[model samples]
Target: MSQIQGWAAQQAGQPLVRSSFDLGPLGAEEVEVAVDYCGICHSDLSMIANEWGMSRFPFVPGHEVIGRVLALGEQAKGLRVGQRVGIGWTAGSCMHCRQCLSGHQNLCAELEATIGGHHGGFADKVRAHWAWTIPLPDGIDLPSAGPLLCGGITVLKPFLAYNIGPTARVGVVGIGGLGHMAVKFAKAWGCEVTAFTSTAAKADEARSFGAHHVVSSRDANAIQAIAGSLDLLLVTVNVSLDWGALLGTLAPRGRMHVVGAVLEPIPVPAFALIVTEREVSGSPTGSPVDIATLLDFATRHDVRPQVEMFPMDQVNAALKHLADGKARYRIVLEGAKG
Candidate 1:
């Protein structure tokens, strides 16, 4: 029957349960990954609840995946059997598109998300296009490397896309899954990092993640205290905040780059941007080459996501922990190892 086993949600807002799918032969460019460790991202919660209105029934929700190559399609390129690899949010793209031809496959109009139309890594095996299946480097920490596939790339893309310089001052809002990694990447990229959190208790932990300064994202005065300072402010929380105060922290010509999936519409005061010539921008996770670059940079700088571990069979518990906002940073599901 070609049955593949995984955890799946029968409907929105339901807990996942054991399920199987009769997936046929792999595609020409496909590579199958045997799940070893998969990170639980906030987006997984959203999809499971249909927050983005794109959830599919009987869905397997996972994207920040670390695994080993189990099989390859006839035309899959650049990888061999039994190789260790990772897959992020994207699983495939139409290679003939302009975005793909230009090395921006992540921006492809027909992008296929790992957990969107496709079953993802919360399972015995998952499949993705050869390009999106990234190669992990030597000396990389396998256990903690899963979140880097998604959250790591989400925060790292801004620096490369916008050319954020080493001397630039960077501020990261919300010191959780995405923000912590942003702090580390900013520090390793030679930028001075400022970490902001609504929870004062996380201030010290944020500092430990490489922030030079820590502030309360909810404190208007604290936001003003660092006013006109940062060259780039990376917002990583999905929740709404004091947007105006945070916007004011940027230096003249500074940029506010958001990687979080904040659901509310952000009202930007035009004057706030006009006077200082500041800018606002956002990006999805990076392309194949960009992910490879992130992996290489992380290896050389010894940067990795801080993660809490859970057994794959205990995935429902892990998802609940993330939903209740109790995860210290990130959660990763451990599967059977080779």
Candidate 2:
């Protein structure tokens, strides 16, 4: 093994600094990718700040990665050298687990997160199990495709799990990174899309992103105006909101699903769900099969994330920009140029 260059935080809540470290050896089922572009996700901030208390120090935080295969282990399958591919939140999983055997590797009990205890794509090179390294389809733009690996799949999985159809009316809560993509997917899937946001400025932008309607998520009246109108409501914001009001917008038997990482308890009136038989649920990133399906759908619909670019060396600046809420949607880091 040789030293690989990357930016990392020495301690929790510390700014990222340029550093070099060894990658040890590639596992039998792993493949190495030469980093090209990596998306800056809010989850990266959580790990950098150790918000979840599961972060390891010297953290190299990036999971949404796009790169070309530089090498592959002897036992790695379905990938070749120089293949352009993407890796998401899960780097590896116990292949024999019930979930993995059923193609739900994301839910495996021993899932290995890219930055959980391992270095991630904020480096010159990164590695993942061959099963999780998905080959990019022909039509996806390389620069903007990174976020689809994580944020895109997070939203897409619910649609597949719930079997939402073309006639369903869908609502997306939030208009930033994840919510914006949800709008595009829902629209492309033939659903009438409504975007919920607190910012008046985003209302029009949400429509431009394929939302059929825009409502102020903070306005109780606006939320109530859409009562019993939606078949599915996707919550993508990390902050707490008026759950009661949001629930009211769903039709009887409609489902409210959470893909966001909201920290506090969401209080729901029992009668709100009990009377209508409405349901609430949450999911993590999707399995490899789901990622493949998402890529195919994105290519077919020409869906791409709105992104700002930063060079890998300027990762700290990029992180600050995302933290300041300055990014229009998603931020991506270009790898060190050869």
Please give each candidate's TM-score.
Answer: 0.98, 0.98
Q: What would the TM-score be for candidate 1 when compared with the true structure?
A: 0.98
* Candidate 2 Cα outliers beyond 4 Å, as residue runs: none
Query: What range of 10 consecutive residues in model 2 has the weakest lDDT sum?
Result: 1-10
lDDT of 2 by residue, 31-58 (tens): 9998999999999999999999999989
User: What's the CA error at residue 250 for candidate 1, in Å?
Assistant: 0.7
- True-structure lDDT of candidate 1: 0.93
| Lowest summed lDDT window (length 10), candidate 1 | 1-10
